[model samples]
Target: MANFISNAFMIPNDLIDKGYMKKMKGSALPCYVLIVRNTRGWNKTTDSMSISQFVEQTGYNKDTVLKGLNTLEELGVIAKKSSKNRASEYTLTDSIIAVDFLDSEKLDSEILDSENGSGSEKLDSKMGSGVENLDKLLSKNSTHNNNIKTNTKTKGNFSEEFEIFWNAYPTCKRKSDKSGTFKTFEKYTRVISLEKLIAILNAFKMDSQWIKNDGEYIPAPSAWLNKKHWENDFWLKAAGLVEQQPQSAETPEYANPQRRHIPTMPKRFKGMNA
Candidate 1:
């Protein structure tokens, strides 16, 4: 009892002594092992083995497994028997071992049912283990994919907030780098609240420098966020009306001084008088 191998199916020593493993190498070896597992593994003389079952056990195509089964029968290593609607039944023969060595039993068809035809619960035990493991693996992957989607959704929500800043600020040119701008917006919001930033931006909309030249002096959206020039009393530093507006058609003041105007000093020098 102590010497019996735990969790092992029995194969007779003559199988090795006769070199069936090397002889049956590629296709037949796995087929033989699988039959041995379901039969002698459960103290039974025979098992009902299906071609699809053979494909699963050996990882070979249907034709390959059928050919191997034929070769195994020719070698007298196993005998096959089948009924009209049942899976094929196989028994190890004298050439390998179990035929002459093991006790033969007249097992009933089934108390429930079985592919081994041994009338025991052994077959489901093996199949249930495989199904249980597959279910567990699928569950873990589902949870992992859900976690990735959640983080992506959160990042998308942050970008939606940036659109507010993008729309209110007008520029001379179309927005070319909105992704880069949103990244800078994220960084900027850490320094100042969105409410405060929006207030400053709204004030700039009416500033003399921004109004004049049709916002030509205003930086593009990406540059504006990176330069952070909108900070530190930007609203208080609006340029007052100028007398020397540019004499260009694009400048509204060229058509009418009351429309808009700009001084000789740039926006940086505003309110810094000597």
Candidate 2:
């Protein structure tokens, strides 16, 4: 007989077969595996990791680790239980294992046997009433399923609104942080409606400043949304309501006022009688 390490953990085949692994990209898989490994004998709902620990164990940069965690959370593979400073407590969700796994035939048989006196009384004692225990388990699973459905609907709504924001943004540069950008949009929309935000984006998209030099000065979508840059007066200059300082040779007075010496009438024209 072989003895297994108490800290060893298992990944379910159903997670991969059901495409849950595919949804977690890059370092997310390794990071999740590390978390699962740490929580092996403990209840799945109490796993935790600090940002420094994740970086040390995964050898991924802080941002990459954070993004991986966010991806897992978004996919419903994990739930963030709490956070303080740079550390966060996380837990594996039921999505990682199939509902059927919880109701395995072996467990059912044991449960059934426990109902009769022929089986170990210890099993029945530990489980209390086997049938009643099964009912509670099923009830908890039902609630988990309902919560997953609600989260899916919320994520869908966020994706739809983010698509609108992405299309209306003035520049396509730095569009990779869609998740982070969407979070900022979600926060802002609580104070201002999505329609208003889109209207403002539309107005700024046509601003001369944003269009100037092929949008060389336009902020990235994430920066623009996070900083609420649309509220700045620069957009007014874009709409041509506010005058921008002239930069052409024809406007030397405004462009370089100190350099413009008062023109003494050319010496040749000084003596001419008009």
Candidate 3:
């Protein structure tokens, strides 16, 4: 249901000059394949798209489009589900090639450290001043830390079942509903503009190399977008899109009595204007 456009949808003109079409085997890149990829961007999610919708959006013949969809499925780049009554939707099968799902080792250590003071403790410490509730949730249930299991093959590659994280929350705010916390594990889509995204990444000190898939670039998930407001605002101001607000006496933590610095009076005070 979320907004998405697949990178595969864009068919570059160079594909023609490079003989990519002639070299493509098995019907040599069908018309619908071109149409569908064009209609969808690399970052689009498929839980909402129907075949009829695709046809309508791409202006491709139903049969031809279906054939191309099947071809893409066979290529193992997309997975299709069959339904008894409603039309099936497609999901990208390119997760491992794109997002770097956090490894179990990292998750385990981070969870444990946050609870009992171990791996990413510093990050938790920073959050403690502003987000005490989050600190409590993260540090609670000490017993859960003992179950440390590591998976060699899983290298933190998120499962297909975890796709909801990308579209579930806004990049700047984390909220909750009746379902509980919104933490999700999934590959991120890289649909947001590169400039905005890179600034977010730089704020979190996360490497952007994960977006490279199969020697090509792909869309990343919104999760990779850092949630720090001031950091993002700094970058936004630098881009000339908005003005950055300077830190003032009214700043949250800095304004507190515990953080305020005592002023040193001068030995000789200047008289007020006579």
Candidate 4:
């Protein structure tokens, strides 16, 4: 059987030529292209895709798909939001916007050059104008580069802090919700410090109840942050402090045989007593 192509998708030349595609490895480009194709238009920055869909569309294994997504995310090419019961939603980051800006600048410069080349006399007259345009382009490019640097720095700081919290947390389940957890952390920054949060997480991580059954009772990171469970007394209870009741004196000896002490009969009466 032969398959016919009924639809075509557009990919930006700059995405490849500008070194973005080269920076990615394995299936990242294919996955990114599929996402861009499924999006409504060039300006649309977000698209939803599940792992299964990526595997089916790109003919890539699940691990490859995951690696591609992780690379894209780490490179700041995309941001993801995941939830307990929903597929991850991905949004193209500012890198795409920068590419668009550069492309437009290049187009404008080409146009200006073409117009000036129509006549030598015109070119001579517009040489100063061309120089001014060139200067402006350089200035704009410099500003764009600065903005990228700032964004990268901010992302790096966030990842560092989030990594600390992730490592301190007891459970590894629902780790895909890290983006959501980071958002929560940002929201609560004024209410609590990251150091304090990490300390509290460490306390919970050592808690008998939290670590019981291999952290089966520990909440997901997103859930813990969302519920502000760090402020709760679960850690104290797990430490065997709170929620523990004292044994009553009236408690039956049979109920706690370890605490029971029975008197021994005298040796002389041992055999004579019934």
What's the residue-level lDDT of 129 in candidate 1? 58
For all candidates, the clash counts are 0, 0, 16, 0
Q: Weakest 10 consecutive residues, lDDT, candidate 3?
A: 178-187
Candidate 4 C-alpha lDDT tens digits along 1-274: 1452213334556676767888789999887876665442223446545565576568798999999988888878678888653446788654543444334545556557767674455444455455556445545434222123355545333443454465445545556666677777778777866655655565666668776787777777877777765466775454333457787989787786785578998676346555
* Model 2 steric clash total: 0
lDDT of 2 by residue, 1-274 (tens): 1464322345667678778888889889888887665553232445545555566568798899999998988888788876543236777765655333344545667667867855566554544454455445545434222123355545333443455466556545556666677777777776755555655565676678878888888887767777664466765444333567766657656555675567787555357576
Instruction: Put down candidate 3 lDDT per residue, 33-55, tens digits, no spaces.
Output: 43334223322335434454454
Candidate 4 least-lDDT 10 residues:
140-149
Looking at candidate 1, the ten consecutive residues that score lowest on lDDT are: 99-108
lDDT of 1 at 238: 38
How does candidate 1 fare on TM-score?
Answer: 0.34
lDDT at 28, model 3: 23
